[model samples]
Target: MRPRLLLVTDLGYPAAGRTYRDEDIDLAARLRADFAVAMCHPLDAAPLMAGFDLVLVRNSGPVLHYAEQYAEFRRVALESGTRVFSQLSGRADMAGKQYLLDLTAAGYPVIPTVDRVEDVGSLPDVPEYVVKPKLGADSVGLRFVPRAELGAVTGQLIQPRVPFRYEVSFYFVDHTFQYALHAPDPGRRWDLVPYEPTAADLAFAQRFVDWNTVDHGIQRVDACRTEDGDLLLVELEDLNPFLSLDRVPPGTRDAFVAALTAALLRMLA
Candidate 1:
């Protein structure tokens, strides 16, 4: 019998820089070929997940939008032993931005990040500092403040506003990189183009993937190149990262789907 997959998504979410609905629609259609897939909002998952063999959370949007309900869902899933892809064990987005500070202190190649107001002086002297909530995503509640005004932005973390050359994202399925994409123009983030990653680039991205240590599910290692031409970690998305399959070549997209399908099958086994 085909495995029953409950794909959780927020079809009506109005994301500022990207469209969540279109990605989920295309992904669900593709998964239907192998599994009996059904789509639902994140809110519905807690009630419906027990009936499915696997619950695939893709592009569910920031859980901050529904914190109480999200906690309830997590509790229920864990209690029931439901198979959650990218599993609820994720320490990145699932846990919050504390990992950024942890990685920075640990001497990882991530952008220097600090959560306290006093530590603002520790970061480089950029004209402005990027401040965002420790639990935010998709630029929600993110703000830029002048160096002088950092004193007023209480209860927020800060990072130097880097003059990054460009942003590149590496996609993975179960610790294996499937493909890469980059936004050539820093101003246009969602306008991604196919990126060919060198062995060194793969090594850089793999460091975080290895650290994440998820036995299964998808992840995207987001990074930016500095003015001196080095990649620094921007964000590690282990939750529902939107796969920009639309931007990749058709063959590449097919290869990614095949890889993901194989991973899911292995996960089920």
Candidate 2:
């Protein structure tokens, strides 16, 4: 008998220029070849999860919108010892934005981040600072404040507003690099195209992937190329990061699906 798989996602999520429904629909169709697949919203995951052998979270939308329910889901999953892909132990975005401050303090190539007002001096003296909630996602509660007004800010992470040339995201399935995509125009972040990464770019992205140390599930390393020709971490999306599979070439998309299928099989093993 095929193992039962519960795929969790929010199909109706109104992503700016992308469709979560189509992507998950395509993904589920592909996965059905290997497992008895069922789909559910993040809200329904906990109740439905026990009936399945594994729960794969994808495009579930920002947990902030359903904080209590998400927390409960996590708690139940952990307490029940139910297997979760990307495993619940991810220290990056899956946890929160705190990894920004940690990575910055550890001197990783991430945008300088400071959670406390007293630490503003640690960042570059940019005219404005980007502030957002630690638990926020999809830019919710994100704002920019002038350098002069930064001292008055509270209860959020802060970083210099980096003026970058472009944003690139490296997608990985279970620690292996799959492919990359980039937004040539910073103003339209979702307008992504295939990006060919140089060796150094792969190394830079791989460093974070190694740091994350998740042995299963998918991850996207989002970084921005600065004017000085350096890449800095923008986000490490380990929790339900959108694959943007529609943007990649057909061959690349096939390889990605193959990789994900193998990873899921390994987890089930």
Candidate 3:
């Protein structure tokens, strides 16, 4: 029998400049070819998950909206030994934004981040600083403050407002590179186009993929290209990274789906 897959998503999620329903609907249609696919909102996952063989979380909106239920779902999945795509062992965004602070201190090419007032001095001196909740997603609670006001900000992650040329995202299925997309216009983030990454770009993205613990799931390594021609880590989306399938070429999209199908099979095996 084909594996019963519980695909978790928030179809009605109002993703800024993106349609959550269209992407997931397309993905679910393709996935049904290999497994018995069922769709559920993030809120329903915990109660309905046990009946399925695997739980695939995709674009479930920000977990911040349903924190308690999301926590419950995680606990149930872990304690019940239920399988999950991206696995329950991810150390990246699946956990929170703490990795930003860790990666910063370790001197990775990330936008330097600090959650404490004393550590504000460590960041680059810039005109403005970006402040957001450590546990936030989808720009929730995100704001920008002037340099003078930076030290006054408390209990949220802080970073210098980087002047970048473009933002690129490298999509992967279980550690293998699939495709990349970039927003040419910095002001229009979701307006992405196919980006041909260089060998160095792949290496830069691969470092985070290697550092992350998830062995069998989709991941998106988001990075920004600075004016000085350097790439910096933006976010390592290990949990439910939105794959902009509609934006990619048909061949690339098909290949991504094939890679995802194989990853799921491996997990179930």
Candidate 2 per-residue lDDT over residues 1-269, each given as its tens digit: 88899999999999888899999999999899898999999999998899989999999999999999999999999999998987888999889999999999899999999999998988899998999999998888999999999878888999999999999999999899999999999999989999999999999999999999588879999999999999999999999999999999999999999999889889988
lDDT of 1 by residue, 69-143 (tens): 999999999999988897778788678788899999999999999988789778888899999999899889999
A best-first ranking of the candidates according to their TM-score comes to 3, 2, 1
**lDDT digits (tens) for residues 1-269 of candidate 3:** 88999999999999998999999999999999999999999999999999999999998999888889999999999999999998889999999999998899888999999999798888888999999998998889999999888767888999899999999999999999999999999998899999999999999999999999989888999999999999999999999888888899999999999999999999998
- Which model is ahead, 1 or 2, in terms of lDDT? 2
lDDT of candidate 3?
0.93
Model 1 per-residue lDDT at 71 = 95
Q: What's the TM for model 2?
A: 0.98
User: Pairing residues by index, what is the TM-score of model 3?
Assistant: 0.99
> TM-scores across all candidates?
0.97, 0.98, 0.99
* Residue 226 lDDT, candidate 1, scale 0-100: 91
Clashing pairs in 3: none
